[model samples]
Target: MKKIFCFLLILSLSAFGFYPSVSSASEKSQQEVKEAKQYVQKHVPILKNEFKKLSRSSSLEDIESLIEKHFKEYPAPQSLKSNKISVFDAFPEKQHKYEKFSGKSLNLNNLLNDIKTSSTGDVFTFESKDNTVKVLLGEFGDINILEQKSISNPSVSKAKTTKATGIQRQTGIGYGTYGTKLYTLWCEGNFSYNGKTVKVISKDGDYHKHPSGSILTLDPRGLGKERDASIGKYKYKEVFSRLRVEGVLGFKWGEWIYKARTVETYIGSTVDGNIYGGLKSYK
Candidate 1:
């Protein structure tokens, strides 16, 4: 009687489509795993070579072009169409920790090294620290990459000022937001009271977009008082001895999202010789 009841239960579940045939499902899963493993074994050498090429690049433009070529040749699989893949300008070191899809931290370089000796049926899964973004190596070696989306809107912060040799120096802090992610920008300008001229002495900044690297550029030219200037999509406004520099942050493909595509930053000098900065974004 017990055996009969078990058989009937199985039949009922199968009829309702609640219990797929265990053997068939298992076989399919095994096949997918096999394919995934084969894909990784076949592509690992090519990926290594690509990284080697990237490491040799000397300029940002060259790196960007190489990455574009790499993507064109090895596009993400269909399973990861909605996920962003983390591409780097150079290979990451073993010490960096990235988040896994399971909410655990993983060392990506270590995993890549392990792939050199990975045997059949071995699976690897990992994620970047950007808001739990994931990368998987199963079921056709799917790699799901998601951007860091934790930045707030742009804002400015005031910083200190100093004076030497009739020249005033000011440093400003600017915050840039992409989606919900935040990154920082810093700018320092030198002003000469005698000539009423402003010169951007030094500038540095970065953003929170994972894998997609951040770049900051500044124009070092001196401007007369009350003069306006433009560089690329950025603009500088000078009013009396006060100066305001504003412009949109530029990004390459695969580095930004569609909703908040344009990130902007502005750094200005107050009449009292203080520095103020802020950032903004738009589609």
Candidate 2:
């Protein structure tokens, strides 16, 4: 009877012993899981709301408001020990502002037509003929090209500036929504007019060097045999006396980019030595 009582007491103690410890452990585990779920439930809405706001905002203000709202509701997780959000979190509006000038906004074809009919075309001649043998800028879009007949133009202008100066000479054209970084369009072709020959020059891509002095890269569609060849090379050249046109263009500035749409042509050069090439209508 004593042995049986001792055995029964041991069995009862063992069962109860596990019951208290396991119940306590299970309660703590459940609490932890509940807290985690609560944290996720709170923060998920914040992230979702911000993402939606970002998608709709054309300007940066809306995005910023959403970010501030999120922070108020979902403080950083405490388990992280140290919580720091990125500067982007501090100024979410800046994202849109930063992206404002990051892509092309003008229709190349339309802008070309706007410029061609807008001017008499001769107004694009380089004023600094003493330093630049030839400079031609489109008065329609951010497009320009300069050729140093002998590479000895006092201080040879940087390629982008040379191009811009030419564009600036145009009366009605201005930089499109892309803002000023760097835009280029160049081309070369052969044409015969009235028995004399002329080399037509044009450009059609963004060729601006970065602040770090790097040129922009090309996408698959932007890349062509024309881009791979040198603008200075004679291949794109055309010897047309009456008026023939050809050239390539490249553009780049910060995150903005553009390309020439209409092929370039030189007009009114029956005299042969006079240079004439400018952006024209697509049709």
Give the winner by TM-score: 1
How far off is residue 20 in model 2, in Å?
Answer: 68
- Which 10-residue window of candidate 1 scores lowest in summed lDDT? 5-14
Which parts of model 1 are misplaced by more than 4 Å? 1-33, 53-57, 82-283
Q: Which regions of candidate 2 deviate over 4 angstroms?
A: 1-126, 130-178, 187-271, 281-283
Error of 1 at 183 (Å): 10
**Model 1 over residues 117-182: C-alpha lDDT tens digits?**
432112222222211111212112222121111122212224323321212211111212111111
User: Given candidate 2, what's the lDDT at residue 196?
Assistant: 31
Task: Extract clashing residue pairs from model 1.
Answer: 84-145, 150-180, 150-181, 151-180, 151-181, 151-182, 156-277
Model 1 lDDT on a 0 to 1 scale: 0.25
